[model samples]
Target: MRKEKRSSKVKDALGSLTQDLIDAGLGSPFTEKELNYYGINIPEIKNISPKKIKVIREKAQFSQSVFARLLNVSTASIKQWEQGTRNPNGATKVLLDLLDRYPHILDYRINKSKRKNYI
Candidate 1:
């Protein structure tokens, strides 16, 4: 069966209602795939260019090592991402997208007493 494309307003309303159901301790009746069947599709993650990655990091005022630590990735991975040698996938891409949308998302300070040394 072909799913009809839904307007963004309809999708947003349905998505919010679905979240409200979950928040009320009643789990969603439909899985993401099932929701897509009705055209309540999840937003796609967009690809970030290496330059954009660098810009995001700089805007966040984090050095490569610090950014890598924040992302739980090796320093090499951040270097590669900035150099266009590799593309971040899966969860990392989602995180980068979030950072792009909300530049101050990672602005919270970690308590020094509770922070682990990553060296």
Candidate 2:
């Protein structure tokens, strides 16, 4: 009898845990943000300013070449982005927008190169 009760308790706990997982996965309508990025709920960002993009790159203290390295894009591309001559596409746009908002997210990489200012 005790064993059956213990098993019932375990099953109840598991059922509750499963329901919690389903609820979190399905998203809560009452919650503020909608998009779940990686795992956490994040507010949606609609657009980015060309000026902020340029300032973000500049604030990283990395040259166009290094900044391009961070973005996995050509230096010419970064140049274009900074000059407002071209806009990033798809994933690059997402990445650039993130960098613009979270400039510190990329500061770690600048220290990696630590190359001479030969440029």
Candidate 3:
């Protein structure tokens, strides 16, 4: 199958599984055993490639150091991420997803920082 088709299938499966879980009274159960038993690991962040990392940073007009600062990670970590040696996880992954989805937020952040310099 093509990459895009496979991804869409996986997304549809996940959506169906989620709905099934909800229908089965698993939603908001908040217990480890229930989650484990249902085979539901819900930290479903997208995995991005090294090239994508560079593209996202460049689209936001940020250098590696600046992008690292924005993401609150080390410059070395950014380098590793962009080199495909590392993958972002947890809160960093969440932030990167947000930035990728709404790049204008970076402009807003930059403007906010400039305003701070006047104070």
Candidate 4:
């Protein structure tokens, strides 16, 4: 959708070729700037409000402690985010965006009999 800077047909061709090369185990030769010119863009992370953060957590059915553990952050951080006292940034923001888009990403089944099988 961010192909406005270039011809869409050209961008699509280059993007597809780049992806195919990566999938075939040949590392990408294109730089990030080059990829962007080809219209292969990463989505920008949107700022999530306190209420939305609370909604996302509740929708995932995780307690603050569990969500914090999954995100490798402190329970206090979750509290702050939900209370509008702080904001998630960088990698945490990226992760939160992914969670917002894919609500079921955190779903996992516990196999009590096989510890290794638990996600």
Q: State which candidate has the highest TM-score.
A: 4
Candidate 4 local Cα displacement, residue 115, angstroms: 10
User: Relative to the unseen true structure, what is the Cα RMSD of model 3?
Assistant: 10.5
In candidate 2, the residue pairs with backbone N, CA or C atoms under 3 Å apart (3 or more residues apart, or in different chains) clash, namely: none
Per-prediction TM-score, please? 0.67, 0.50, 0.56, 0.68
lDDT of 2 by residue, 74-100 (tens): 999877776778777778877877776
* lDDT (CA) per prediction: 0.82, 0.68, 0.77, 0.82
User: Which window of 10 residues has the lowest lDDT sum in candidate 4?
Assistant: 109-118
lDDT of 1: 0.82
Give a tens-digit lDDT track for model 4, residues 8-119: 7777888989878876968687888987887666568887899988888888888999889888899999999999999988998887877887866866633346566444
Off by over 4 Å in 3: 1-43, 111-119
What is the Cα root-mean-square deviation between model 1 and the actual structure? 7.2
Kindly report which residue pairs in candidate 1 clash with one another. none
Global CA lDDT of candidate 4, please? Answer: 0.82
RMSD of 4: 6.9
Query: What 10-residue stretch in candidate 1 is worst by lDDT?
Result: 1-10
State candidate 4's TM-score.
Answer: 0.68
Tens-digit lDDT track of model 1 for 48-113? 899999999988888999888888899999999999999999999999988887876876743478
